[model samples]
Target: MTKRIFRAVFLVSALALAVGLAFLMVVLYQFFGGQLETELKNEASYLSIAVENDGAKALEELPEHAERVTLISKDGDVLFDNRADASEMENHAEREEIREARERGYGQAVRTSNTLAEKTVYYALRLENGDVLRISSTQYTVAALLGGLLQPVLLVLIMVLILSGIFASRASKKIVKPLNELDLDDPEANETYDEVAPLLGKIRNQQRTIQQQLSAAKRQQQEFSIITENMSEGLLVIDKQTDLLSFNSSALRILGAKAAPQNQSVLTLNRSEPFRRTIDAVLAGGHRTELLQVQDGFCQLIANPVLRRGEVAGAVLLLVDVTERIQRENLRREFTANVSHELKTPLTSISGFAEIIQDGFVKQEDIKKFAGKIFDEAQRLIVLVGDVIKISQLDEGCLPYEEEEVDLFQAAGEILQRLHDPAQERGVSLHLEGGHIIHQTVKPILEEILYNLCENGIKYNREGGSVTVTVRRGEDGAEISVKDTGIGIPKPQQERIFERFYRVDKSHSKEVGGTGLGLSIVKHGAAYLGAGVSVHSEPGQGSEFILAWRGKK
Candidate 1:
């Protein structure tokens, strides 16, 4: 702005100076021209008087002068010339000055020489002796005059230009100083030119608008940050340039990043192939979902593009921890295969015995044994099917049972009575300990849990071992623990004991003649009653399985 002002000021100043100088030169030239013409008239008058008094001899006697003199007769014959031979001079009667002087008594005219470089001013007087006397002076033309004064004119012009530039620079700064010092915070309050007042008012209005927009934007950013920061799932916002614009702590944790990565490429957080593919697909205006290994678990990455005017502008990425879901899926597949294998064994034996009888390959004396063996395998198959159905019901969580007040000690006694024959056959004694403790729970699920635990104890116990079922009131809940003098589980296998069809002693399982799902059913039934079940075991020592339910509200 200062430079513009300076340029404008300097240009105007220089132009004005040029015009003034030109006008001055023109006035001086005209003034000098008039003076030259007046002097010629005066010289002509004096020469005419001298010629009239003394004739040709008086002109001849004139001293050498800068002015030219000419004498011509009334008949237009040149009688005398100061700088030329009289006899060789042309007639002057037809000349403008001579003709005018013949008629008007005196006349003046200016004419350019043949070369057009000089102008001669002629003044003629018609004398009484019937002759005209003329005086003329030659001067350079206006163009020639200016050319001769060019050096001084240029010097003055340079000096004027220099002064103009200096003054213009200072003037421009002075004129713009008020604007520069204006308080933008209060533009209308500034003491400045009235011409600039409207602009200041606009500036003030614009400032207000800008401030309002900035405040609104800041609030929106804060709101967005709060929402994203509180999310449990990981979130990421990226720009079209692949730069990470925003993220949450969950995103950092999911990516296993040690620190918040600001203004960096999203790939810096996780460069895995699936993660990169998800980002790339979303950036191309597509939606993508990929399962990636994150740390020791699994994450489901969902990516979607952000669009503007039907164009992809950026992307939004969401990460969900699917570790538990994936583990459940794997367990389901394993359970299906194990159930098929467990059922196949019993079915195969039943089929073989039936085929042998149909083929008449069994003797009459062994018929009873074959039939009894088939009955045992059929019973095993039925038990396995029943257990599978129970597990399915627990998983579905829609059992036709309601919560009721159940006495834990009474429930343990009932379960022991049902297993009495099995315990006696296995030579394991059952003991009911602690007083009756009432707990609010689904009665059917609780009974199922207690039954499974006791059954498992008798089936897996050593000969002459004892099973103790205890019920007690805990600080926060009612507790039921089933402890057994059985072949203990190893520490490494304890964690997996609750898994369906899992067994610590595979060889012992065949002799026991029970589905390897008792502990799994115990776990599932406890869960349905909103209780927690855990086990403690050492390889050579007996095992303890404890189930605890929350106190009534």
Candidate 2:
């Protein structure tokens, strides 16, 4: 703006100077030309009187002068010339000034000299002797005058332009200074031009509206961040270009991303086939679910297209950890098969014994023995059915027992007493130790856990071995440990000992007459009662099972 203003002012000043110089030169030229013509007329009148009085002798007697004097006859003859030979001069009768003088007494004409930067002014008078006298003088034209004044005019123009530029620069700066220093952040607070007051007021209003919008956007972002950050499931948002737009920390963790993947290609987060395929399908406006292997576990990826105005705009992805669910499904299938086989064994035995009697294939004396065998198999079936029912109830969490304060030592004694006859039959000793520690728990569940552990100890122990039950108050909780001198489990198989229908020695399990669900029941019952059960064992040494519960606050 400053440069433009300077240029404009400078050019206008230079142009004005040029125009003024031209007008002054024209006026001066015309004024001087008129004065020179009047002088020529007077000189002609004096010369005409001289020529009339002295005839041709006046030309000879005249003093030296700048004006050219011409004498012409009425018959169109050049009589005498002051500056040139009379005989060589052109005929004067045809001259405009001479013709006018003959008809109108006196006449004058101004004509430019072709060979010089001047014009000739001629005055002619018709004498009473039928003769004409003419006086001519030269005057410089406006072009010559302007040429003489060129240097001074140029000097004045240069000074004017320089001053104009300086003034324009200062003016531009003064005009824009208030705008440059305005406080846009607080527009209304600035004291500037009133001509721009409306604009400043509008700016202030816009600032307020922009601030409100920014605040609202910030709050929404915080809310979204809170929701996503706290989620357990991984969530991801992407654009149609497959660029990662937003994602939660859970998404980063689930995808094993070490850095933020925002605004990058979704494939940069994960390059696995399932992940890529799911993203591709979703971006194509399809919903897809795929299983992705992440380290030692599995994750379920669900991708759905995000729609905007009935068009695919982007996609949303959800990641769920399904490792535990998959394991449960496998366990359920295995349990079903195990139950079928276990029930078939006892039912087959009972059917065989009864069929022998019904077919009359046994003697009368052996009939009682066959009935006894059938009864024993029936009893085994009953025990198996009862164990299955208990496990199912624990799995479904439908137990009717409620919480109560029970004597832990007393509970151990009661379980041992119930298993004492079996212990005696196996030639294993049963003992109860520790204090009468009272623990808060469900009595039925605790008793069930105790019975299963104690019975297993007796059933698996060697002859003359001892089965001891100890109850004590631990640092954080009540503890009950059932230790046994038995053919201990192998270290490698210890973890699986709590699984349903698992047996170290299948032949020994048959001889011991068990449903093979004792330890499984103990595990489930301990879990339902909010306790932890662990075991320590060596092959030849005794095995110990410990159940601990957190202390009441």
Candidate 3:
């Protein structure tokens, strides 16, 4: 705005100067032209006084200025033309100055010379003797006058433009100063501006509030980082631009990656099909669960919304390490299937034989043996079904639980008495390690876990090998370990040992009448009781299974 105004002022100034100069030149031309013509007439009349006083003899012998003296007679005839023949000259009576001098004593006119075709200005006067004296000169027109002034006019214009540009540059700075001072970087300039004090004050207050908010946001970010870093699962946050803005250590470890990735599209990240589908689902407005199963194992991504002002801003993905859970679920499914299949065989056989027996299709001597086998199979079926139901109840926390102080030694002795027959038949030696103590709770579950663990140990052991049951109170918990000198589980199969229906050797296990629920029950029982189960085993080296529970004193 200021520049425009200044430019307009300078242009107007230049125009005004040009117009004023032109007008003044016109006025000076008229005044000076007229005054010079009047003076020429006066000089013609008045200089005759000096000539007359000097006399005709003096005029005839006129000094060096005689060239300007034109002697004319009273009767419209030239007496003596100082530079021309008197007789050859034309009549002067038709001349404006001569004619006017004759009529009104003096007059002036401009006309083209008859001989030369050049223009001239003439001044005339009536001499003392009624004779006329005339003088003439040429004057240049206005165009010629202006042309003569052109150089100086152009020089002045150039100076005016230079000064105008300098002033405009300075003025521009003044106008732009206020805007620059608002940056708050130049202390001196900022201090100099008090016009916008109110606005600056408000900005300062708002800045303070913003600073506080930024500090709070920073704290929240740090807190979230710490929480996710230590978490057992991975977490990923992506923005609307599909950039990976935030993540955690667990996420890095799970993805086999390191370093923080930001400002990159989701496709640029881990690009497995399942993971991409999960990202697409998140980009859409839906909660989805995508499971990625690879060679190492399974990972479950839980995508959720990050909302701001009731609108989704981005997505938060939880990368849960579900290898264990998936394996467990698969085991549960297999367990159910196995239970159904195992029971179906016995039931079908029993139904078929009973139907035969009912029809009296067998001999009386064979009836006892058939009945005995049927009863044994039926017993086995009952045990298997009962064990499955018990495990279900234990998992659901519906199993009856009672805590008490009991003697570990005495409990072991009682359980050993019941397991004696199985142990002897298998040629397995049983050893008791710890004495009685007050640290006991949930006696039934405790006994069940011990019995099932020991049974599995003895069942899977080598002939004439040993099964040792050691009950001791650890610093934080009660521990019971079942160590067996058996055909030990391989390193790879150790993880699946506690899974339902999993047998080290299916043929060997069925021959020994192993229900496969014993170890499964032990696993579920110990877990339901808020305990941990750890196993150490290698092929041909026997296995040790340890269960840890909170000590009850």
Q: Which 10-residue span in candidate 3 carries the lowest summed lDDT?
A: 184-193
Candidates 2 and 3: which is better by TM-score? Answer: 2
How high is each candidate's TM-score? 0.76, 0.74, 0.66
Candidate 1 residues lying further than 4 Å off, grouped into runs, are 39-73, 76-89, 114-116, 127-130, 175-326, 349-376, 406-439, 457-487, 549-553
Clashes of each: 0, 0, 0
* Tens-digit lDDT string for candidate 1 (61-161): 77786578888899999888889898998888889999999898988888997676898888999998768888888888878888899999899899989
Ranking by lDDT: 1, 2, 3
Which run of 10 residues does model 2 get worst, by summed lDDT?
1-10
- Cα lDDT of model 2 by residue, 1-553, tens digit: 6566667766776678778867887787778777888788888878877888889789877667758888889987889888889999778788899999999998888789766788788898899998988888877767776678789977877787788777777877887788788899888789989998999989989989999999999999999899999998999889999898888888888778888765789889888888888888998999999999887677899999999999999999999888788878878888888999999997998898888889999999999998888888899899999999999999999999888988889988988888889999989999888999877789998999999899889888999999999998778888999999999999989989889899988898988879889999999999999998999999979899999987652
Candidate with the larger lDDT of 1 and 2: 1
Q: Is candidate 1 or candidate 2 better by TM-score?
A: 1
Give the per-residue lDDT of model 3 (tens digit) for 309-344. 877788988888888888878877887799888899
Off by over 4 Å in 2: 1-211, 239-243, 256-265, 306-314, 504-507, 551-553
**Most TM-score-accurate candidate:** 1
